[model samples]
Target: MVKSVAAPQAKGKSAEDKIFGANNRAVALSEKLGADKVINGTVGSMLDEDGNLIMLDVVQKAYKALTPKEIVAYAPIQGYPDYLEAAIDQCFGESRPEGYIRACATSGGSGVLHHVIHNYSEWGDEVLTSDWHWGAYGSMCNDNGRKLREFELLTPDGHFNMESFKANVSDMVAKQYNTVIIMNSPANNPTGYGLSDSEWDEVLAFLKDVVKGKDKNIIFVSDVAYLDYSGEKHECRKFFKKFGNMPDNVLIVVAYTCSKGFTMYGQRMGAMICVTPNKDIADEFVAINQYTSRATWSNSNSAAMKVMANICKDPAKVAELDAERAKYFHLIQERADLFMKEADECGLKYLRYISGFFITIPMEGSQKVCDELEKENIFLVPLGKGIRLAVCSVSKKKIHGLAAKIKSTLDAVGAKQ
Candidate 1:
């Protein structure tokens, strides 16, 4: 073989995003057979009843009104001042926890993940998250020269598995003095699961105990990328208050993104909001993440930042945006509900789903089932242990009977449930 030129660490890297691969196949089939005949459930974004991408009306208008300077000018490495403030205000909503909070704009929620994995963990250290997590978490950890360890996400009765969580976390903290723990919640990806206030309390209490006598640091990251579509605004955010007055060693970072919430997927606007009782740590958060931002993407999208700032600063615009988002939120929820109801009636098992865009069905030979489903023009993402159906992209009419179809597909493939 010819001598490789890439750095040793980068040599064997290949792009194998199965989700996008499956989507490409779905799109091709849609073109061949027409859109109505193909059930394309491989998308990660929201699609309307007619299968068109849904962009918020308010967001579109704000973008249209932006001046050329606003659209083209570079944003501060730390993001525009107003945008940072608005990000914090919007992220916390009524559940603004008491802490020395700070925000730094990132390229997107993915950028926040990149920064946290790079800055918080040591090389070769294991970053902790749930077993049934967004696949990108593992990819990020691998890219950052760290390992990703997972705790069992759910128990036998379909609840948060606290025992497994504590056990795995204790092991990681014992091995590595500092551990970065990522909890994607208020609508976790793939499973559509959100922890309740009581569940949050259990997690915090466990972390508090883990650091009782050790020189340890726990960087808790909340990936709230789907928070807007999860539930009622304030009601869904109540668990945020649990972050208040944490041990100085336990730092909470909320990775807030406008991709799903504001329908600004292409804009790549997001922020990393840190909550800590220590002012010094909060200040250090901004200093370090901004430096990373400069080294990474240099700066975020200025037009998206300005649009958010302008909309957030005006109450009327905020109201309009909220109403528009709520409309789509309900639409997504209705689609989720329809599939869930059918799943329940058909005795199809799924992970505990509270609110979010996707729902996962646990099974063996998931890839086989997904491939078989594709033969029927029904496209879904196959996870390691389950099939992730994008309820966000499927319309209510199409969502109906989907559970039954999947159940039959699972049986046809001889995939164990």
Candidate 2:
């Protein structure tokens, strides 16, 4: 007889996520064969032409310069104060909305996401996001015993599906007391897609309308994990200003991560920043999320927090970090440009790519085509939406005309639509 074990939430729990599986295969193949012989686009983090993981000069210097005490000591449960403020400023830039704002330290963006879903959404209730999204969102929801509701990510005109979003949001609001929505942009994972300023306005307008005369709560989150690599200074954060003057029932949360921004993937430093027109909401946010922090993970990294705070607060250091990052930023841009140009030439249609680590090419038989591509030493992760090509991690040498190869493979396998 099976012994009584594991909670109900833990029963029938299993996920053989193909993304990580494919990534493992890619890394194994790269090791078995030579790295130069393979186009490994499976990993989401940045890598250079020599197949080296990117490390920001400022992060290395600032972190190493920390005292042994800073490295070894315990931090405040919510996060060191400086790190919390820096994380907020890093997310909003000069365009921070005029509203009450607060932040708490987290293990990483994923930690913040977990807290958001757990605290804001009812247990066993439904949450929402776009059809084309980072896979981890689904995992986080599933782990928390919440259902994921997805809407079309794009319209026929290749813009944000505002109508579909409104329809889904309204449907959920009618049924659920709290509707939590995740919107990742300025380099959405698995799809290099970013909504324009006007598109953002449309989304806000719809959300504002949904809150009108309704008792439901709106928890809108901006998953800004890759904000730094998304675009130019101030440009990537222009959407934040729109969050000001929002209704009291609406709460905007931005999940900020040091992993992608500072190239400190293992440090596991992140924060959750909340924005609201009401002071009560802001105070309640700090109270509730801070308690959640204590219950789970406790606090984030002290040394890493100090490092980021030092980098952000110092003018000279900030400039140095910016200059160092600009070099790789442009390198990523060049890679994306080459791949997109080739895709256009090869007649391969992909999702609208404003700027991001991924570009999803829409086609059927994603798994079949991806497996076939592996034989030719070319690797990418396939999603239900499409095949995700990580432009940020691939080199220019391999990116040039790579789309043509993918198209050719699709044709050979009769996977082309």
Candidate 3:
């Protein structure tokens, strides 16, 4: 009788998430087997060598200095002006494009997806992204009553598949009034691949060709959640300059987040930045997305915004924060270098990895492989085509020969063909 009272869409909906399910199992196993013995690679959150969550000292210092009003008072629905400015500066740096820019406070990069999916695209429209992507894109689209369409992420020769990208975007724009394309680059999660500047040229050129004279709207979402870890700071962001002076119909949305960038995951602070040559479109983006935010979470954390502004406003604070993040970035790089070297030596195959929190190894029966790995107290999250290992969460010493161990495990499971 109670089930009969639920709406059609809400019926049969449960709260179980696959990634979280795997993470929970990892937690239980780690407690029983001891943390040092287990390789916990279930999630993207950065962890120290001792299996503790990482928090930047400078970020902590900045946040702890906030006043009570900063903690409790309601912030503007669009976000505080100073935080908006900081988000812009932090995201684009010196290579900021020549366009009108503004940000709407979002819960995280996930919130950016929610706002764009709800505000830009119509109902029943399928959002487009690459095949290898963060799993939440699909979750967010499904929850919004929309769907996700993916094109091949890489070509047979290991390059960005521009042909597939163009074909998919062109077809989708033909069907829908607005086509939203989300590209996770500059340390893409789970795969760690970032497009080169030439690839960016191809992407922008293709987009310009797609909507040359058409009235169709193209919302290009560049999700740079892992940008800070990708490569050299300024070089990685040079692509942002390419967004300037694009056609009025094309709007660039940067899904900027403090969760990864500033190590403030729990605070859930970030911004949905819109860049466009047309000033009116930028204004509309702020208005509509803020309306969506007001109707959803109402407002963001004020203390986090204040801390972000404080860090950005002070030159010394900026350098301290940068150096703090840089230390962890190098730590993760060392872990990855060791693992990649060992994986190569052992002849184990994985996706192309740049520098990021995760790397994926291809294997059949993902769930089964993950289950078998648990017997060794080694936890990894299963994906559609492989298993994702979060190098950012595992230490260099533990990662020394993880690849060989996994290879041995695959052979034992009769999956190493």
Candidate 4:
């Protein structure tokens, strides 16, 4: 008989409301710089002009001639079988390492990272990576309640720091966490540094020593996203063979992406590879990874799988795609070279490693500099340590002008300070 008591409305913001959502650096820079027609190197977005669109048509025609599937149905949770096989073949190439290799299709390189962290690592576990890394590494790990640990990334000679790497691995082992070490090699992101064979030997030696007698479980996840753009294919992939007869406690996961290699950013195709000395481990990895994929994405894009499968299966089409990829790779290198040269002429102090589609400019007040550059119709990503400049999408004509713009911005800002 009594009137229903009305529930009090919430007085304050929810937890989601408290959280900062937008990328403030990118957003502020975009706004101050006038986002409308600014040239961008922030995200790895490739803008295909009329010419590039025409090239895509030619590639599509080749694909149709080979495997002409009109409609694409849902792919298996694990992925298209033929597509997975071709991806593995393309990665390993002629030199197949002696290990039990299994792969699972992922949304993209970042998707593979998400699956590995969510499925394999426990809450509050630690992941060790380079101090300077792709920003998303921290975002993904923190979202999953995992702690990211880092060590200094370079030596005095501007090479990979094996000593610092060993120290960090040994510390993680001491903490008794199921350690996951992600090595973004052969042109690491942000900095663009690769490990030499001797450097690899040192790191491997440390791993062998750390997990020598203990039953500790260690996973090495190699992010080889920029493999094709490294100038030398076989030389860059040599690290994969080193783990051929790896220890039972140690497993290798290769996160391979088609975004850079195949220029299929919209397709969102990639793979999570598990390499182990035992077939049983490989089987277990596949089963658990499939569960992770189901719980999250459920299934991958069918059209992407179909197109990739068609291209991989046809030898002539594969050759043609490779040639096309090489053309872009060379263009990226040319742009990077020109930008570096311009930076040198301007007396800019940048990180000395350059091997990929991007480079980090070591300027003070990177955010302010980025903002100033945006006013001039130029855009770049600002990192905690430095500013990341992508030289891939911009034209050769834009390279020198962009460098000059950056120099001017820095000078003006410096004078104000």
Candidate 5:
């Protein structure tokens, strides 16, 4: 027998991350067959029309302008005072909710998820999210000794399934009394669906009713990593105003990231902000999350924090950044439009794609479909229920004829959509 010293929980842990696996395969094929003949859509990062990664010019300039000290120094465990305010401002925009708000730096949007899971939930507790969610949510919960429960994201008619959501929340609250829900919207990963303003109202109203007389705590985490690329700037954020005046037991945590918005992917800069009707809760959010930061990552990237602080402080810089991002936004939109149009014509079934980096095709045998597509030099992420196409990285040229090919593959495999 082999000797081992790993803890039970840590033993036999290996990551076979399908996303990276697919990307690696695509790269190997590209090297053999040449890049021009391959359609690589595995990663969720913006790419130019020529298949080169896009880093916003304005953000690049800002980083290049940073002093050596700014790049090398350690940021505060919580964050710089100005960067915290900038995070709140960037997250809320004009739809600032009426609440006692506070923020702390994080590694990225993923770090925000980690801190929320650690701080808001009890060990062995069940956390809630939509069924068609980013896969990392499950990993994070499992790593922290929490179970993840999911509600159906869409009804058969392609609308938000409030019934499923309410039922799931009720079940979770009954079991744990303290429920933590993570909602990724405005550009949900794997699927581009976003809840409407009315849907937002319904969700908040239902939650308000759930905790009416019961002594319960609800922590709602809005993972807005793709908010900047979702749609019209202020229009996409209008739902945030509804967070105001929420029940004291209902706390709102906004996970904001500069990855997509500022094209700062590798910089690993983001913040987790709390909004509460009670000032005490807001203060406690800062204290606890800051302490968690120290215990975990220690601090975030100082240069990235300073870049955001500088950008947020100047109106001109903000305008320039927005303008530059809009160009790529429209570029991605055009690519999505091309694929969606072709999908419609070819009878390709996909999740309701409003706007975002990825579009998921709901199917029974996604891994098989993706495997077949890979043979044709087309690589995509295979989720449990479907294949995710990263329109953010695929240019319009490559997007052409892509949906029809996928539909044909599904048909060949007799996969149900």
Candidate 6:
């Protein structure tokens, strides 16, 4: 008798299931928030008058310009050569880190993260990162049967805790598992903190010691998702140069996404860059990454890649785009500053935010507080640990109401105690 071999029940939840599950957290919270005017900080997009995303203008123009023939064809599995070259040049700029490196296009930054976890790390391997991080890190690792380990992020003085970081690295090394450390910086999400040159030196030194003469591999992945939002562009770009000089045991992978920078969220175009000490390692990393990509999403959107490449290649267009983006970036800063000022006036302490879309405010029972805020038509993410306010999406006119709502929630919670 021929036995039917049904596909192995998929491990964990399918990607679609996971995404919807994650989103339901916000949806549930929103529903509880009631009929109040909702200022949705959880959403990542900028909306128009009709509540549709405003940033689609850039993408629609790019799409209309493409030839019908181009739209109908398949992009190379590795991605268009021109798109790859343009993306690499735009990211690395003139410095072009002095190593043999290659880039592969992926569905988005999230896809790149999943590919790295599956391709490079073994099952049950541990990924190290700060305690405060984008929530998706845990989801990605868990779905793949990998453990997510964290180190305390702040010192007593409220700076990047180097000692704690090094100790965490040592603990992971002693366990003898291949480790991947993801640092999201320049303009980090949630807390909005960036590492200084000194802190970077400390991290590199610790990694050097951990991997010294040990045949085991260590991967340092940088998620530069909010790179363009930083006020100091030159300083932010300088950090990429450090990756060029790391040892061979250290593989530097940069996941750069156009979603946030170009306001191309729906396009889902992003690059997975692997930089190695020499040509051979670079070639191998590229091959493995491409294999992972093929096994997963195949290749990313061809039309989006072409548009990004064209815009990046034209200097005049690039300048115009940067100028336009700067207006929104500054608006984010202005709104954040206003909120911070009001938070101070109300004695509502929050984590220091240099530059980024969100700020985390500490409060007991954050989920409860978030629910209450929703009743007032003020919506934000309840992070369990704290409340994450997306300053970028909330209009300047809405800042005062947000501040008042947050302060009242905190006060009520404190009084109950």
Q: What is candidate 1's lDDT per residue for 261-346, written digit by digit as tens? A: 89888889999999999999999999999999999889889999999999999999999988987888898888888888999999
For candidate 3, which ten residues in a row score worst on lDDT? Answer: 1-10
Q: What TM-score does structure 6 among the candidates reach?
A: 0.90
Candidate 1 residue pairs in clash (backbone atoms < 3 Å): none
The C-alpha TM-scores of every prediction are: 0.98, 0.97, 0.97, 0.86, 0.98, 0.90
lDDT of each: 0.91, 0.87, 0.89, 0.75, 0.91, 0.76
| Model 5 vs. true fold: TM | 0.98
lDDT of 4 by residue, 1-417 (tens): 645454443233134310122223444654675543456676554433311222343246644664334245677999989889978987776656788999999998988899888877788889989987887788788778887889878876688888788888888888865688888887788777888888887787678779988878788888988887776566667777877877878888989887777767767889998889999999999999999999989888776766777777888877787777667777778888888888888866567665776787766688788777766656677667777876665667667667767777888888221
Encode model 2's per-residue lDDT on 89-196: one tens digit a residue.
888989999899899888889988999998999889999999998888998999988988899888866788888999999999899988999999878876778889
Give the C-alpha lDDT of model 6: 0.76
Better of 2 and 4 by lDDT: 2
lDDT of 6 by residue, 1-417 (tens): 645554554333545532234336545754676423456666655543233455735555777798875666789888899888877776666556778779999877887788788877789888888887888888899878898888877775668988888888888777755678888886777788888888887887778778889887788888888877776445567867777777888888888888887888878888888888877878887788888878887877888889888787778767766776677778778888999999888778787788888888866688788778766555677774678887766677767657767888878866221
- Give stretches of model 3 more than 4 Å off: 1-4
- The local lDDT score (0 to 100) that residue 288 gets in candidate 3 is 95
| Poorly placed runs, candidate 5 (over 4 Å) | 1-3
Worst 10 residues of 2 by lDDT: 1-10
- Which RMSD does model 5 reach against the true structure? 1.1
Estimate candidate 5's alpha-carbon lDDT, on a 0 to 1 scale: 0.91
Rank order by lDDT, top first? 5, 1, 3, 2, 6, 4
